[model samples]
Target: MPITRWIRGAKLSFARLPIRGGAPSEPAYIYRDPWKGDAEQGARIVSGRFLFERQEYSFPSGRWDQGTWPEPAQEWLHSFCWLRDLRALGSDEARLTARALVSHWLSYPPTDLLVKNASVTGARLAAWIANHEFALASADRRIQQKFMERLLQEGRTIAAFLPLPAQGWKGLKALKGLLAVALAIPEQTGFMSRFLRYLPAEIERLILADGMVAERSPEAQFQAARELTEMSIMFRTAHSSVPPILETSLDKVCPVLRAMRHGDGALAVFNGSRELYSSVIDEVLAQGARQKLLAPSMSQGLFTRLALGKALLIMDNGPPAAEGFDKRAHAGTLSFEFSYQRHRLFVNCGSAEVGAWNKALRASPAHTVLVADGLSSSDFNAEGRVVRRPAHVMCEHQTDGTAHWLETSHDGYYPPLGLKWTRNLYLGGEGEDLRGQEIVEGERATPFALRFHIHPDVTVIRDDEDIILKVGGMVWRFRQKGGQINLENDIYVARGRVEKTQQIVVESIQYKISSEDNKLQESDEASSKDSLSENKEKKKFSQTVTWLLERIPE
Candidate 1:
């Protein structure tokens, strides 16, 4: 390690050395838990059975040892620290189990890095602080004293090693832990004031001017909003005024959150966000200040949204997220998701529950866009990082007071094949008609495939020249003019399970480019005139796929 990093590490180690001033006073739980508590999971844990991530284990001897637990189980143990499940059971037996679990955890702190992760530690602190009442319902004063001692120790450790709040989602979470510590032990005068000094500025720096989170993820935005909401409530309960900047951040974010939701209230599965439980989203939104829904398009978010009658469309017109925030970013630039009222009609095959399924879901083919030469537009590795992203992504929106549309293009395949994918979308005022065209241009013959995934609940049937979509007591038709369409088997990963699904694929379309086309491409003004005059001849060489989606009465 470098000398500076080594010195920093040494300082961090010393800083976590359990600052004890004899058991800090515990404040009452002020923030309400937004997530649903699982009583069944609590019952299982109390009975010496543990289940997590769809897997189960039993420990009837009722003992858990540090260093022996599997890496996967550490996260599960953190969830147990929340005490939501135990609180839900509301029984003396469950209360005893909770106390014993906390005692065991304090006795043997895990050395694993996962246990010390900023996000995990923040969650542990919040859970422990919020559930103090349930955990300390014991008659033994010694047990209560030990819990407070350990809680204080954990708080100090977290504050000492907390990452800078500019570190994206993890940083936000670390701040959340520090805030919980301050709120839970207001008598810690120095610590509470120190937390207030940095909290407001950190919140402002991470929240973008347009209200989107710095990571450009809907999921992270939701988590940030929820944290701010809790903090606001805590401040109010403690008779302290909520920070104006914090309140402003929450107000600005709620509309963006509302704009990102589908008609069914589920967030768009864009960037790296998955389709988490919709109810949790509802709870978060309920806490924010009410605001108008987002308009048709957001420049800061770099996405176009069109709400026409019952149809809602959200298209990614932005580039891949920048470096530090791109870990969970997907390679599906220019991809989109569509819905009719409460039912999703078109979507990208989203991220799955397991890491093993990441490569397939993150590939360009899984999105509702054209993949050229079978290469992903944005290159991603197995770990979901953007190894290489397109250098440029351009988007333009135009409307004629009735028809709304946006045109977008990306240069992801420019280096390898000198090809670009351009898509134009048009939606009718009534949203009864949706139209699009894909144009592929380059110097060589490039093979491209276009995919359109349907929601698992919807069924598709092929007619003579089009595909029929049946869902939500309505019918719609999918027709193509320049590409062959087929029904292919697919998988939908959401709601904690992977289910068999289907996708409509347009394939085997090749476009050939020549030296003349390349030279003409260099002069934009001259090429525009020439291409219009030679439109028919250009079609012979260029690949153009035009399609239409129209509502059909049942």
Candidate 2:
């Protein structure tokens, strides 16, 4: 490792050493937890178990520190959510449970490395600071002092080991924790200026200009926005002027975040995103920071959106998240999700919490895209690391008259299958008619399959060469040419559970061109037009698939 990295590691390691001596001061300011809590969930925690992400796990009562917990549960433990949830109950039982758990963990601090995660540490520090008033409200002086000592130790450790460059979400979260510490106690006041200086730079680095997280997860984007909002409140409460960058970041982010939503108000599950409940989106936008400007057709985000009339289509036109950020990136390049008014029509299989299902859900076949050779466009290893990815991708959007056109192509298949895929989408002026053209170019014959995952609410009816999708009062006809269509069973992972769903698959059709047309040609516009005519003897084979979706009148 480089000296700089080694030094950072050493500093972090040194900071984790138990500090028995320290005093915890009551926070001068407390920022509200933007995410609402559930008292029922808090009841479960008091029972010595955690029900997180719809997955439940139990630990022996009062022996919580003796065993390793399942994920989400483990992460939840480190997140200090018991304290946050305790506020929801505001009951004696909840307070006792919270005190017991905090005392247990503080007494027998887990050796698990996840406890030291930058984001978790930051989040826990902030959570403790925000709920200190309640957690330290105990009449017992010993209990209060122990809680304060733990908070001071955690805050000091987090300050010493704040995430470095390339930390992505983890670094931003660490900054939030440091800022919390700075706002809470008088001794850590210096962190305020440093946090203010780093806040803008971190936002600019992690949040793209189009207001998407660099990781490209809609869920992650929302988390960043929420933290930034809380930070803004913290600064205001501390009588420190909010930074212009903080406000400006929210301005750019809120609208794009809004655009990513479906009519149902849930976020699109593109890259490792899960559908979160509550009117959180409304709460974020209600601050008046959101601009009501029309959504852009293409963003720096992995998804490209085109809203025409009552129809909204979000297409994945960008590559997977970069290497370090690929933990949550899905191999669904060129996949898409579509919604009309209040109903979702076409959708990608939302992300899962964990296990084999989660890995399978991230594959290309689980999305609305063409899967070549039964493999994902971007391959992944057993550990969810991206083993392969597209080398180049090109996407463009144009408007002609009242019609909107979006064209995108990727070379993800070129490396293994020697095939290139391009898709063109045209939305009619009234958004009643949607047309698409898919072209595959390759040197040799290769089996290809086009998949279109549908939302569970949409029912499909076969009509010979056409497929009709009915959702309540609306109807959409899916027609295709030159490929066989089949409806296959699928799964939709969303809102914390998987539901049985269906997908439309179009099998590949082979086509061949004469040797005269086989040679690679220049990309000049003039040559491209005449190239077809130049190969007169070329017995043209259908190398394209055309499909259309037209709204049927009531």
Candidate 3:
């Protein structure tokens, strides 16, 4: 929030650093012209013209007192605008900005640092390292020295920054990679080599077995990937191969990355990040392509090309990855993300915007499941407290050509109510229709709940036989034999400004079971007795409803 305020009022500009003029250089193999134009064209415009243009600063100074200057505000304003301007102008201007920015950044001492400020600084420094092959190859020695020194200072700050033990793993990995690059810099070899030795253990602890980062949010995963990819590029440019673990880690991660993408080029924004960066995925994919690594196909819109060579299926078998140092992971477990033929299905609820009011909005019901009792998993509370350990069990899953089946029997939810829920999902083989069943296996009959956060354009209708969902004129029906309820007409869950009212509906039905009797008269009595028992059971747990849903159509 403070950073957001700082960004609004800052004066930032970039001037293109001179490139030794010659025959125009051939574009690098990995380089694709950005949407606006090649980086150079944009750079020239910003450096020669835009830098002189004045603009109003909406960012706050956070300087309540007159004596002390808002150092963080200044650093953020310059760094944020510098990065934006670099992208607009080209790597030449970016290099120039990086050089000047680093020099200014290093002039300050480490004790006066802000965590977010350091994080962004690391990202920009890493970006410079990535583009070094093209932009910095013929740079001035003074600029290079200043760049290296600034990067080292960032590394030290990151290393010293107190990160929460559980979630800081990804940030730590990123910090380590950045530091490794700084160490590889000619002047910082001794210090960096010693720093680099500790990275392997750190990476092993942070990265999960399935290539998912410790913090499971797609946004965090993407950010970590961007940072890692940049570091790897820098290492390769320095003539050093990447660490073997990173190479192996990325292989497992690519599918999940692919799975998290929607049919649109945008990622399924979940957790706390919704601001789409310019060509973030494109840069990563370009790097991956040049390295001969298989990357996901991504497009910007409905009719854009959908890369299908890489198909992925992701299941949330555990609670959100531990939020060690990062606060972006969500609380949804037993959920899934699937991508095939350029179509994505069943994504985590996209992220909320960052700031104060948006804090509770992050826990919006539409973003996740709100069972009749509580959350789907008990690993963490809304305040992010780890109340219970995640249950360990074999989650049986099988996928055939037509449908996928998932069965999770975990004790994680049993402690609160002596209840065990085995959730089974049958997704149509073609990935169109889905049917789910939650069997409560416990001494007492408990309420079973399922919530669906529909996309904005979706339309929902509750019918006697089924619940029908219409998206873009396509109708999909979910049929239930017993009875149906519409909770949207009943409950109110706090969704943000996007929807005036978030609708949630609940439905229930009853079934009758009877057996043939030896005689007709005896059969009548047996039926009556069975009816009495059923009535008593229903009365005992009248609150146990069958259906609860929160939906948004595509």
Candidate 4:
């Protein structure tokens, strides 16, 4: 390890040592958690067990061991985040159970990598401090002192070891904890200065100027926006002006977040993002400093938003993020999500929370995009970084009285397969007709598949070569020309759970081109022509898929 890292780690280790002298007193400030917790969940925690999807897992004798806890509840247990749920109950029983949990953990803190995680520790600090007003108001002064000591220790650990253990937007979580510690103990001038010194730079680095998160996930953007909002509260507690960078970062993030939402008001699932709670999303946005200046444009943030009448479309229009930031990046270049009014008519299979599904959901087929040779546009290596990504992604948008049009292409497949994929989308004046063309062009015809995942609520009915979709009283017809069509079972991970869903897939029809046509040159403009050639051969029927969706009257 580098000398700097070694020194930092040494300092962190010392910070974790039990104090030999008098314990610290309660922190000066009472940090608010900002987001509400579920009282029902809090009741479950107080019951000494967790209820998940109607299943119960009683806490084991060894509650502090990572392996002892149910896999689904490990992070929540370790970070003590459920304290918020307990506090939400705001009853004597809830308080006693919470105190017991904290008291037990203080005597036997988690002794595993999960508890050692930077983000986990950051969250632990934030949670422990946020609810200190109630969770630590015990008559037992020893418990109160221990709580303050733990907060200071965790905050010091974050300040010393950040950017080393913290990656992508996870760093924002750590920064929030550090700032919380800073505000809680403004008497510690050095600790406060440390946060102020590093905050602006970290904010600028993790969040792009256009407001997209460095991780390139709209879901991560929500996390950043929410954490910053909470930290804005922390800054205010300092009795000082809120940092300008914090407000500006919110300005940049909130708008992209708004544009990334569908008609249901939930975030678009892109780059390993799930549809976070729309209510929490609304609350966070409301807390943000209103943009005094014009907010950043969605296009500048590598997203294109189309809105007219009741139709809303959000498309990912950029290449994967840079190295360190691309760990959770998905092969979703040119993919999109579409909704009409409050119903999601077309959607991407969102990122899963755990297991192999997390990695599988990051592949191109998970998104509403064309996958060449059944492979992702971007490729992830073992470490989760996007090892190969689109080198060039070009996007153009045009809006006229007749339609809102978008054309986009990416070269992510070029490195492995020597191909490029272009997508064209048009939503009509009345927002009823949505037409799209998916084309794969390269040195020669390439076999590809276009997968369109539907929202679980949308009922899909097969009609030979055509498909009909129904959402509540709204109905739409889906038709395709060229290639074979099939329906496949799938899953949509959203709102913190998975639901059974189906997808419409169009597979290319392979055919050997004449020698003269085998080497047809590839150009974005050529693939995006206003009209396809009348001649089947000239149109490259084997490499194109055209589909349309028009609202059908009830």
Candidate 5:
């Protein structure tokens, strides 16, 4: 049942093979004019203009016909605007267009289908191949034979698409799928063995000892996980055993997948990806659950049904895994996604719609921790370049059965003045309820601004002794008494900006300090200058401040 149901009696059709014969010729069905201003128009545009246009296609690396970039491939593989709008015209037109699109896709052969933008090509190709394989089940033998022939050819190409010396972990994922397909084909075992030899080296580089993917985007991790899972399935279905290298790959995939789920069935939209592949994860988790493969309490979430469970800790710790591919990795460093009891408690403010990184929706304030005046730790313009580094200064995480703690620091505002900033969170308790604390430390007693970005739909209020957040008919409250902070709710903040506030409370040993160090630094530096007038002008410059939050136990 994990497979999608197919429509019956849908005979697969194709135009006669183009030949140098003396026979009457007709316009191929793929070239038929589409209805103007109708859904079919889009298909016509794609097929006749985009897909078939000679000028738009280029054989990159002598293998695949690709657009100048990834846009075209993304359009062909995922766009539904054409099919959905065309379906409104009538089932016949919709079906015809759909069939044509499918046929067009199958006809191209894998060598000419993948785009040159290697960053997402592997994942995209894997998805296309997986879906196409399903579609082929209903295809006629002729179509199947043709498809299989192309697959075999592509399988050989994939076998030869060895990892590049400079591509780093990027090629590992694509190669993994390429190897899977190659191994599944009966005659390609020789190529498969050679490909398998390189996997352990790649695994050592891409996967951390703790099972996190090195680049740290939850979306990337999910994509990698899906590919790994699919490869595993492909080999298993063929009654073939996984290569030894896969053991390390699976070790990374399993735990990270568990950590990336939110309390809801959906995943935390991190990095450039937004669409939730819940069904895919569900299927994988189901397999794990059946085999009793999941660690107890490690991946507890509503989406963790006996099958197809969700991830528990989603972290966009850094940019895309592959160095040059992800243009949308955010400036927020060491940012993370967490869900407990199905409630999402922490998040980065998602990226805005305007700008170059617009397609990278994960960079917004709604999905990160860099708040007011605290610029991202890394430069956005330097993305995918050799100079890129995490925007965060430092980050660390530790977990023990019932307790977990995470800490992060950054100097996003340090260049203007000399200062550093740090933030920490600690969560502990047993069973139904949990207690937690946050502390912000810095080099200067600057007023730090922390803005906790929450879903606009949620209600937030400060009670006499506690901070309360309510969402979807559920409530959680954090009480501050005797310098202690206690809470039980899905408290999630995409961004928290804190600055100098007049409010201060003292209890036990915890102290609250908020000051504008940026202004103070400017003032001091100005005082040291001989030009008082110039110093005054400089002092007028705004100052950057840091905030500190300490939790006290009752």
Candidate 6:
């Protein structure tokens, strides 16, 4: 290690020695975890099978952190949120199991750099503080003091770090932990005041003006809400007023997150988001302020919502998030999801927590959008920052209270294939009709494919040129004029695991825009010759594919 690194490490180690400054040993509050955990997970943990981040490990008793393990599973173990699962089991044996694991962890504290990661440490500290009753209330006095001392040390460490970079939502988790410590133990006057000092600017930098996260993810939005809600609960537990700025930030975010949900109560799978349990989402929403639904059509946050009767749709209309926040961003520009009532019909394959699945799902092919020559509309470099994304995305939304329609265009393919992509979507017929038109304007014949990923719960069948989907009592048809349609095997990973599903892919059709196609329409002919709009319209030559979804009268 360099001298600087050694000195920094020495300072951090010195900082951990028995938190002093004459504060009381006991905390003022121990708040319960607001979210529930899986009883199945609790059983698996007790059985010595550790399942996390889509990887499973079977270890002998009490040696979870000792053996060779997947990196993510190790992080999960050290972060210590698994206590929720044991607490959910709600048995004396379960509590003792937790106590044993926690006690061993506190004593031996894993000696890896990842274990000391600020976010990991923050989360572990918060978990230890929040669930002390179940984890160690009856443990020996020395063990209890050691736990508090660790909490105090980690609390001050992250409080000093303040805003973390490249950690979008995970950074908030760290802050959530810091806030938990500050409020739970009133004696750490410095920790409480320091937390209040740096909060507003951090929230402003992370959250955008319109309530969406800077990362442009529905999952991030939901997680950020959970963090803020816990902080609010912490304030209430401490008998202090929730900071006005904190409440304001929460209010801005909840409505936008609520509007992103499909007809199903969970969030729509966009960016790095997945379908979190709807019950938990409802629980999170119920605790804070009432979130009024956003407008059926909007440009802010660039995710448009349209609903008529039971049919609802969310479309991504913006480019990938600007650089620093684009780590979890996807390249599915102009893709949309559709659902009816509580059932999803079309979706983008949802994202995962980690591993190859997440990387594979980030490309444009995993979404319901057009791909030119199998290239992503946006792609990440080795560092995972977005590069080669659509340069200027234009979306025009229109509605008349009874119908919703939008026109979107992007230059994502223009640079590589000399083609520009435009899509038009219309929803009408009291939630029964959905029409889409895909137009590509290019110099020569270009091959492209359009994909629509169907939900695993929806059954699909092909009948000649028309396609059919059935879920519950509702039946819908998909018909297109583009090219051959094939139903291929796929998988849905957004519900936090993988399940067999299928996708409808319209194979590459060679399309060319001819001179006649660029001729002026009669409406343009009537306009004055000096009109700039007329000249622009004359250059718009394109090959178009139109499709529709309508209910087959049951």
TM-score of each: 0.88, 0.90, 0.63, 0.89, 0.59, 0.90
> What TM-score would you give candidate 6 relative to the actual structure?
0.90
| C-alpha lDDT of residue 333 in model 2 | 90
Clashes by residue pair, model 2: none
A best-first ranking of the candidates according to their TM-score comes to 2, 6, 4, 1, 3, 5
- Write one digit per residue (lDDT tens) for candidate 6, span 98-122: 8877877766765566645677777
Cα displacement (angstroms), candidate 3, residue 289, comes to 6.0
Residue-wise C-alpha lDDT for candidate 2, range 1-554, written one tens digit per residue: 59877877787677666656556534566666655677887888877677765677774444334555656567667778567777797798887777676666666765667656767777877887776666655537776676666666666666555444565566777788888877776575666766776777777778886777788777877777777777777787778888788888887777777878887888887887766663877776665354665346336775787778888788888888887777778898988888888788888888875667778888888888988879889988776668899989888888775788989999998888688899999998577788889888775667888888888899988888788999969988998887888888988887677788888888876676634454532223246566745544333323677888889975
RMSD of 5: 12.6
| lDDT on C-alpha atoms for all candidate structures | 0.73, 0.75, 0.45, 0.77, 0.43, 0.79
Better TM-score candidate (2, 4): 2
Q: Which regions of candidate 2 deviate over 4 angstroms?
A: 17-21, 60-72, 163-165, 288-298, 514-542
> Which 10-residue window in model 6 sums to the lowest lDDT?
289-298
> lDDT of model 2 at residue 105?
62
Best of the candidates, lDDT: 6
Worst 10 residues of 3 by lDDT: 297-306
lDDT (Cα, tens digit) per residue for candidate 1, span 17-133:
665656654444445454567799889888877765455666423334343444446565754553888888878998888878777766666565654566667677777766766
Model 2, global lDDT:
0.75
User: How would you encode candidate 5's per-residue C-alpha lDDT over 1-554 as one tens digit per residue?
Assistant: 22211211111011122223322121011111111224444444434433321124322232134435354444344322244334434455445554455556556533332433232334433443444422334556655555445444444444444443334345665565455445445454664675677666666666666555555545556655655655566666556786655655776466656655566645555654442546656666554322324323222111111111222444443433445444445555445544445555444444422334343334334343533244344445533432344444555667675655555565554544334545455545432233333343443333333434444344556666666556555565544332432222322222221111111222223333334545555566647456555544333222222222222232
Per-residue CA lDDT of candidate 3, range 166-219, in tens? 444345444643454453444545435544565566566655665555565556
List residue ranges in candidate 6 displaced over 4 A.
1-14, 17-24, 58-71, 291-298, 516-541
Give Cα distance to truth, residue 111, candidate 1, Å. Answer: 1.4
